[model samples]
Every structure is written in C-alpha cells, then in structure tokens.
Target chain A: MVRLNNLQKEYKGFKLNVSLEIPEGCVTGLIGRNGAGKTTTIKSILGLVKPTAGEIEVFGKAPVELTAKEKQQIGVALSESGFCMIFTIEDVIKVLKASYEDFNEDEFRNKCTAQSLPFDKQIKDFSSGMKAKLRVLTAMSHKAKLLILDEPTAGLDVIARNDILALIRKYLEEDPTRSIIISSHISSDLEGLCDDIYMINDGKIILHEDTDRLLGNYGLIKVSSEEFETLDKKYIVASQKDRFSVTCLTSEKQFYIDNYPKTVIENAHIDDIIVLMLDTSKEG
Target chain B: MKIIINNTSMVPVYEQLMDQIKQEIIGGGLKEGDALPSVRNLAGELKISALTVKKAYDKLEEDGFTVTVHGKGSYVAATDIPLALEARRKAVEEEFSEAVSKARSAGLEDDEIREILEILLEDS
Candidate 1:
C-alpha cells in the first residue's frame, strides 16, 4: 500500500499539499487538469522531488531512502523519463537488465514484439508512441511490485493507447499482489480500470473515493425550469444551464428517479462529474 | 466486412456494435462458426469501451446469435437466425421509409436522396 500523510511540496508558484491512500490490488488514477499538481504528486511519490513537509511511504518504506533492492520493487515511467537519445532499443534492454537484478528479458522482448518496435532502432529515431512503448516495456520488465506511470499515453495514438492499456491489464492479471498508480487526463481510461480515483486541483486533493461508490453516489439530473425549481438546493452540488437546468450530480440516482418521476436522471460519467465538481464556471 | 458507424448517430455504442455485427453476418461477411475477436481485441480495434463490447457480446449470446466458450473464445453460433433477423430487417425498413418520407417533405427528390445516401455510404 502507498500512503501520503499530509504531504506538502512548495514551489515558487505551486504548492502541493495532498493526502491520500492508494490501496493495493487496484489501479488508483490520479486525475487533474494541467498544472493541478498531478505530475508533482507523482514526482513526490517517486522521490524525484522533496516534500517540504508531511510524510510519503511506498510499501512501508521511504521512497527516497529506499535501497537498490527496495527500489527495484517499484517501477516508474514519467512522460519526460527516457533513455539516452543515442541508445538503441537493444541498448536500453541491456542497460535495464544491468540496472535491475530481477529484470525479465522475455517480458521485455514480448512487449517489444507486441508494439513492433525494432530493437536495433535508436531511441532518438522512435516516434513518441514508440518511445512510450519502450518506457512501458522497461518499467514492466523489472518485475516491480508497484507501477507508477505519469501521462504515459499523453501523445500516443489510439492503437498505441489501447495497446498500453491492454498491457497494464495483462500485468495486473499476472500479479494480483501488484498495484498501479496512473496519472492521466483520460477519464475513459480510468472509468472502468480504476478501483479508486483521486482528483487533485491546484495542488490539493479535492476528492478521493472508490470508482463504484463515486458512480453510484453521484448522478446527472436533467429537468425543465419547472422541475428545476422544485429541486432541493441542499442536495445540489453543481448546476449548469442550457435550454434547461441540470442539477446536483448526486450519488443516489434512484432518489431522483423515484422522487422526480418525470425527471430524466442519466448516468453521470466520470468526466462530467470531475468537470462539474471542479466547476470551471467558478474559475476565471 | 462491410460495416459502418456514425459519430453523429444517436444510437448508443453497445447497440451500434451489435447492429454492425448483425449487418456483417447478414451480409455474408462473417460466416457461421467464425471466431470473432476477443472483447478486449474488438474494443481496442473499435476505439470504444471493453464494457461496451462485452455488453454487445452478451446480448448477441443471449439472443443465440453467438456463443461464448469460457477459456476458449466467442464464435458466431450458426446461420439459422432467420426469424429474429427478419424482425430486425423489417424494423430497419420501417425507419428508413419514415426517413425517406421526411426527406421528400423537406424538398429532396428521390434521385437527390439516393445520391446523398450513396455519398454517406461510401465513407464507411
């Protein structure tokens, strides 16, 4: 399990003070818009950045002070993390094998085969998607207990994105003891995959809940002006006005379904809830 | 296989998947006992949800149009789906007739509507 107790990281412009727990045997998606400290939180967890205050622990050990053996148990792939530009894919495989004692060459080769990345091709010659695939292969090859990826699919095409997601699913299936933390803006990727979602905004965790609970607890209510006026304002979390007003993305979908018999209570998608909860309307 | 999906189509994704597969089978592109791609494989290919593909596959199996074998895969059951298919085809024909009449009332000639449909069909 990964735990961050009142973790605080201060920058000239950004200060991230996030507290959350990522349960094992599940995917925890860290979601937020750009500049919302998603990457910073990931960096802190990986020990690439020093938290000014609070505590951070992975598998019950401080990530920064982790021994090489302990470090080998964790796999990290940040968007900007890549091999030396001049190194060929084969060279990367060799380097990773040397770096981690538990590296699985066969798994690395299989991933390379699946992605169709030529092992002899230099890293600098690869497309963004190819590079991302290489990073994924390297990360997975280490037989790590925990996998942390930051925007690994940011610039990838649909095929490549699907391939990456498939690989993650396969990995999870292979090792039930393993856990993953994926930080991305793609809500669909997390919708079914994540056991829990942690939404961070402006360097703080605004909400954290199990994926099923979030979906079950919140809903989208579409109503005409007449029905809108009858809605209890206390239950309303957020509202948007179009030709009509939609109110309170609540968890109890059936409450509106039964109470407002004539009202339409559509399922609230993860993206809609996040966007509404963040309430960009309140922002400049 | 001759298949099509519309981004602007009001049809939900699961229904679209089921319809496309049915149309492909009826068009003689997907034969009986043919092994369809796994749920994950098809979802990856279609750029949609795995759950959505599973929903379509579940409906297909429940209707006896396909059979899923655990630890093996999903396959087209058999070509003995006439009655169920005829009902679906008739529904489509009824909807198409309404659409055509609506087009006629909106000032579209038969030849013009055909040309427009041909253009739309060509893209898929």
Candidate 2:
C-alpha cells in the first residue's frame, strides 16, 4: 500500500499538496492536465523528486530509504525517460538484468515478441507506441508488487492502449495484494481500470472517489435559469453555464431521478467530471 | 455465460454484467452448480478491470443469485420454482414501470398505451 499525507512540494513558483491512499489491492488512478503536478507527485513517491514538505510512505517505509529489495518490489514506467533512446532492446535487457535481482530475461523477450516490439532497433528509432510498450514490458518483466505508471497509454493508438491495460490487469492477477498508481490524460483508461480515482488541479487533489461510485452516482442536469433556481441546490457539487443553460453536477444521479421527475438528468462521465471539477471558476 | 459490455453505454459496466448474468441464470443458460470462470480469466477475456468482475460477483452473491466458494469460484445458486418465476416477473415489472414512465412523459393516455401494448403482444 502507498500513502501520501499532506504531501507538499515547494518549487520556485509552484507548490503541490496531495493526500491519498492507494489501497493494498486496487488500482488508484491519478488524472490531471499537463503541469498539474502529476509527474511531480509520482516522482515524489519514487523519491526521484525531493519534496520540501510532506510524507510519502511506500509499504510502510520511506521510498528513498527503502532497501534494494524493497525498491525492486516496485516497477516504474515514466514517460519519455527511464530507458535511454539510443539503447536497443538488447541493451535494455542487459541493463535491467544488472539492475534488478529478479529480472526475468526470458519473460521480457516473450513479452516483446507478443507485443510485436522489435529488439533490433534502438529506443530512439521506435515509434511512440513501441516506446510505450517497451517501458511497460520492462516494468512488468520483474515481479513488482506495485506499478507506478505515468501516462502509460498516452499518444498510443487504441490497440496499444488496450495492450498496456491488459498487461496491467495481468500484473494484478499475479498477486492479489498488488497495487498500482497510474496517471494519464485518458479518462476512459481510468474509468475502466481504476478502483479509485483522484483528480488534481493547481497541484492539489480536487476529487477522490471510488470509480463505481463516480460512474454510478455522478450526474449532470441541464436546466433553464428558472428551473435551476427552483431545483434543490444542495445536490450541486459544481455548476457551469453559458448562454444556453446551466449544467449542475449532482453527486447522486438516482436521487435526483427519483425526486425531480421533471428535470432531465445525464450520466456524468469521468471526462466531463474532470472538465467540470477542474474548472476553478465553477468548482470553487 | 457470455456478457457484452458497452463502455459508452449509460449503464455502468458492472451493472450491465450483473443484469446479463442474472438473466442467464433465470433463463437456465447458466445451470445451478455450474462453475463460473475465475475473476481474472473473465476480466481478461472481457478486457475489463478485474475489480469490475469482483464487484459484479459481490453484488450477485449479496443478492443470493450466485454463491462463491472461497478458493474455488462462483456458481449459480439453486432456486425454487416460485422464486424463479418471481425473478422473471420482477425483471418484466422493472421494464414495464420504465415504459409507463416514458409513455406518460410522451403524453400517451392509459387507453392508448394499453392499445399499443395489445398490438405488440399480438404480434409477438
């Protein structure tokens, strides 16, 4: 399990304050816009970035102070980093072999072949999808209890994204107590894979909820000004309006449907929730 | 049993799976004592999160429509004839109430709704 307690990082102009727990047996998704401090948060957990304030504990120990065995228990696939672009898959194997005690070269080779990742080409010559695939393959090749993935599916086609998601599922299957923290711009990926999700904006966690609760209960109701005025405002978590009508977010969809028979309610998808919740003007 | 899930559908994926599996049990497609696929296998085959399958299985077990033996797997629970009939009728009643709500919103009178229902029933 991973826990972040009032986790704050002070930079020259930006500050990050986050607090969340990735349970022992679930995928915890982190979603945010570019520069929303998603990478900073992941780096903090991995101890790649030093945080001026806050505690990050991975499996009850400080990430940076974790022993080599503890460190090897976690798998990481950072975007546009980790693996050198000039290195070929052969070189990657050699490096990983020397780095981790439990690196499985045969499994790595099979995964590369299964995913159609060519070993002959350097990482620089690989397509964006291939590069993404290699990062995931390398991370999964080792028996890691926790996988910290940042934008593992970004810039890839649908098939590649699916392959990565499937691999994540396989990793979870390998151990019942395994956990993962994945950040991505793709809301659908979180909607599909995550047990819980956190939305970050301005370097802070804005929303955290179980994926099922978010999908099942979150709703939006678009109504005219008069209708919006008469409706119960207590249910509104956030609201956005233009010239057309006001869209009010309700935490419970079925509650409104059962009580407000006249109002038209729409299911709130994660993407829409992100847009509405991240809208500083409205969410406030 | 086969279950189809539409990610874009308004209904949540686990809810869709729950309904489909319940229907299968009611229709005898999934026989009593027949073993269901492991959660991991089902999730992999469906290309969905294993947590979703776990949620659905949990809901099913809670509702007494399915039974899960730890270290084994889930199976359709045996139901009495009266319970099976009640399950079928309840499913129909749920759909009927939704239809009635829609008809009322559309300004259809009871008589008109009954007439359309009659015609549809005769065709079927």
Candidate 3:
C-alpha cells in the first residue's frame, strides 16, 4: 500500500504536486507524457528525491524513515542502470545478496533463466533490455512486497516485455499482500495490469480512478449539426467544429443519446481521453 | 469455452471476461470444480495485463462462481445456483435496456434499435 498526500517536488522550471494512493494488492499506473513529472513522482515515493512539501507512506511506514529490513520489502527498477556497468552479473548478485536480507539466490537464477540473460557477462556488454531485466531481476529476487518499475519495458521486444510482465504477475501472486507501481509511457502495458490509473500533466494529477470506471464514464458523440443543436450543452466535454458538423466528448453519452435521437455515440478510449484533456487544458 | 469479447464493443476487457465467464458457468460449459486459466496465462493470450485478468477472476470469486487457492490457482466453486440462468438473463436484459434507452434518446425507434442489434448479432 502506498499513500501520497499533497506531495510536491520542485525543479527549476517544473513542479510535481500530486496526491494519490496505490491501494494494497493492486497495480496502480502512473501515466503521463514526457516531462510530465511522472518520474519525479516515482522518485519521491522511493525517497530518491526529497519532497519540497507534503508526505508519503509506503506500506504504513514513511519511505524516508524505512529501516533496512523494511527496505527489503520494496523493489525498485528505474529506466537507467543503477549498477556499475563494469560489474559482472555474478558480482552484482553477490552485492545484492549482501544488500538485502531476503535476497534469494534461487529466485535470481530463475529470473536470469526466464529473461535468458548471461549471468557471467559484464553489464556493459548487455543490451538495454538485458540491463533492464537485470535490474528487475535484482530488485524482484529480494521477494519485495511492493515493486516500483519506471519504464521497465520502454525499449524491449514484445516477447521480452511480455516475459517481464508475466514474471511480475507471478511475483505478485506469490503473496496476496504484494503491490506494484508501474510507471510507463505505454498505456497498453498499464491497461491489462493496473487496477487503477493516475494521469498526470503539468506535474499535477489530471485524473485518478479505477481503470474500468474511467473507461465506462467517458464516450465520444458524433452528431450532425441538426442533432448537435438539440443536445444539452452541459453534457459536452470537448468539441471540434467544422463546416459540416461537430464532434464532442461527453461523460453522459446516454443523456445525449436519449435527447438528440439522431446523434452517434461511440465508446471512447483511455488514449483519447488523455489527448483531449491535455488539449483542453492547453486551450483553457 | 464460448467467450465473446467484442474488442470494439465499447465494453472494457475485464467486463468482457466477466460476462463471458459468468455466461459459461450459467450455460454449464464451465462446471463446478472446473479450472480457470491462470491470470498470467489468460492475460498473455489476450495480450493484456495480468491485472485485468485478475480483476475478472477476483470478481468471479467474489460472486461465488470461482475460488482461488493461493499459489495454486482459480477453480469453479461447487455452489447452489438455483437461479444462475435467471440471474444471467436479467443481467443481459439490463444491459439491453441501458443500450436501448441511450439509443432511443438519440432519436432511434425500437425497430431501428432492433435493426442495429440484429446487425450486431449477425456479425457476432
């Protein structure tokens, strides 16, 4: 379980102030465009960066004050290689074993085998995907109750990505008490895995809700000019006008459908919602 | 066994899973003690996150149609569903009502709605 209350992390030209919760036993996606402060928010949760304001709690204890034993229960895999590139896989294993109390050699081996990485090779010789896998393997082999992955599948082949995701799913299944925060630019990765999603823009959370609920709540309504005129204006969210007619996003598609008998209603997707929201914010 | 997931059906993937599984159970395709695919397996097949599959599985377990044993797997439960068919029918009927209500509000008549439904049904 993770809770962030009024969290604010400041930079020279950007500020990430988001209040969110990743409930126990669920994968909560942290989604945003490039430079949307998604990585900053993840860092704050991991205590990699000190917050300028607000508070955070991971599994009921402050992330900043977590003991070494508590740290073993948390796994982190950032996009970049946090390990020394010169270290061989076996050496990294030894280092990690000494670093965490719950580090499992068997699990680490299984991870290497699952990812098909050569454990004896130096990390510098590994491809980007292999490096990312090694970082994840190291983090997950500790049997951490909560795993934090920041763009863990950014540049991997489909097979590799699926393998990693399957491993994470299996890892979570090992314990009912486990949770994960997967921050990724790929919405599809989050789609099937996350129970809820947090969409941030301009360093602020623009939307946070159960994934299914968010999808169910919004839809696209296309209408002829005559039908568009009959619909209530209050239900319209975003509208595009042309010489012919208008298209709009609506939260209450049923309301408009019931009223404007000739309008078209289409189910909207998460991607559409994100683009429309950002566009609206920019215009506003 | 017979799962209908309209990818463009405006329904979420998990909901599609839930509906199909529930229908299968009610239709007797998935009997008591039948093993459901592990979340990972189904997710991989669907090319979706295991989380989505888990959502459907969890809902099934919560509704008493399935039971998940930690580290083992999910299995259909042996329970008295005296009205399983009735319940499924009602669930579907409600969806139809909602869809029709929305369509009618947009100026479609019952016949027009039926035509669309018939087209969708034919496609399926």
lDDT of 2 at A167: 87
**Proportion of true inter-chain contacts also present in candidate 1:** 0.00
Write model 3 residue lDDT over B45-119, tens digit each, in one string. 565655667889999899888999987889988866667667767999999899888999999988999899889
Question: lDDT for each of the candidates?
Answer: 0.79, 0.86, 0.80
Relative to the unseen true structure, what is the C-alpha lDDT of residue B5 in candidate 1, on a scale of 0 to 100?
A: 47
Error of 3 at A155 (Å): 3.0
DockQ of each candidate relative to the true complex: 0.04, 0.39, 0.31
lDDT of 1: 0.79
Best by TM-score: 2
TM-score of 3: 0.80
TM-score of chain A of 3: 0.90
Ten-residue segment with the worst summed lDDT in candidate 2 chain A?
A275-284
Q: Give the higher-TM-score candidate: 1 or 3.
A: 3
Off by over 4 Å in 1: A233-235, A280-284, B1-124
lDDT of 2 by residue, A1-284 (tens): 89999999988889999998987877889999999889999999999988788899998988889998789989999986868778999999999999898899999998899989987888888889999999988888788889899999999999989989888888877776778899998999888788789999889988998887787778888899888888887778887777989888889877788888788888888898987776744446
Candidate 2 Cα errors over 4 Å, as ranges: A280-283, B6-12, B43-51, B90-115, B121-124
Model 3 scores a C-alpha lDDT of: 0.80
lDDT (10s digit) by residue, model 2, range B21-90: 8888877898889888788777767766667788999999998888999988898888663686786799
Q: In angstroms, how far off is B98's CA in candidate 2?
A: 14
